[model samples]
Target: MAAYYSQNNPDPSPTSLTFAYPQTMDWNRELLRNEPGMLAEEKLSDVERLKVKIRMFARFIGMKGAETPRWEYERGVEILARRIERRVRLEEETEMRRKVFMGPRAWQA
Candidate 1:
């Protein structure tokens, strides 16, 4: 674990390490791969939230132009959202069919 400073330091360094924004699409893809169960809206919300954090980090590092366009960010999110919606619909349909086929038997222990 890393310890954090309680307050801002009085002295600032002219030479500090900074990193540029890596490809956000790569980040989006990796996030999706890691969280297969995330709902579509949750994924989109997470992406937006992460974008804000990335922007703040860029500013803290004294860098400019780290923000990607809104459309670029939404493109990947929308694609995943569609897939999630389709999956949910399919699951609901499957459950409905199972209930219908099982009828009264489904209620038995």
Candidate 2:
């Protein structure tokens, strides 16, 4: 193991860690925020969070194991539509706030 620490040709200069595709810090931060890595901040157990999430998501798509009826499927679709509408409204509100903060659009109120 003499080669391990024998000055090793100027320490081989720590093979440059590089990304194939370029991405900004904001995009990377956004991605990490949605990732499971954020679970460390949780006061509750991850098990509880995961179980809750599973129940919540299962309620949405009607989980495969849960013998769902036709009406249940229809209702699930309606619920999803409502959720999307709410998300759209929130996003629109954020966009309006950003526009107002930036103060560029003459038409914005």
Candidate 3:
């Protein structure tokens, strides 16, 4: 048992571990500085929210070592936004056609 312990536990003293921590005052100052901006996200429109999400996703993908260029992601987001707009337009047109077919009663319904 002693031989096994000596072989496996040669320097069993607890090692001093150093952790880097930001000064508490600096951390609190930075958090206070950005607090209002964090709250502003709740006021963004649907499209703006989507754009923000896409931008965050692009950043995450870039961090993951993706070879795709930034412009490509931006272009793709623009194309997606245009498609969404077109779809909304078509839906509005369809609703208008239904209203016309259903006569003035459609408005009451």
Clashes of each: 0, 0, 0
lDDT of each: 0.57, 0.46, 0.49
- Rank the candidate models, highest lDDT first: 1, 3, 2
Worst 10 residues of 2 by lDDT: 23-32
Lowest lDDT block of 10, candidate 3: 18-27
Better of 1 and 3 by lDDT: 1
lDDT tens per residue, model 3, 1-109: 3343343345666233222221132323221223443433223344644554555555554555445456545655665565567779989999998767666787788
- Model 2 TM-score (2 dp): 0.33
- Per-residue lDDT value at 49 in model 3: 44
How many clashes (backbone atoms < 3 Å, residues ≥3 apart in a chain or on different chains) does model 3 have?
A: 0
Better of 1 and 3 by TM-score: 1
lDDT of 1 by residue, 53-108 (tens): 67656865669886666764675567667777889999999999876855666778
Clashing pairs for model 2 are none
Q: Which candidate is the best by TM-score?
A: 1
Cα-based TM-score, every candidate: 0.38, 0.33, 0.33
Candidate 3 vs. truth: CA RMSD?
16.8
Clashing pairs for predicted structure model 3, backbone only: none
Candidate number achieving the greatest lDDT relative to the actual structure: 1
Model 1 earns a TM-score of: 0.38
Ranking by TM-score: 1, 3, 2
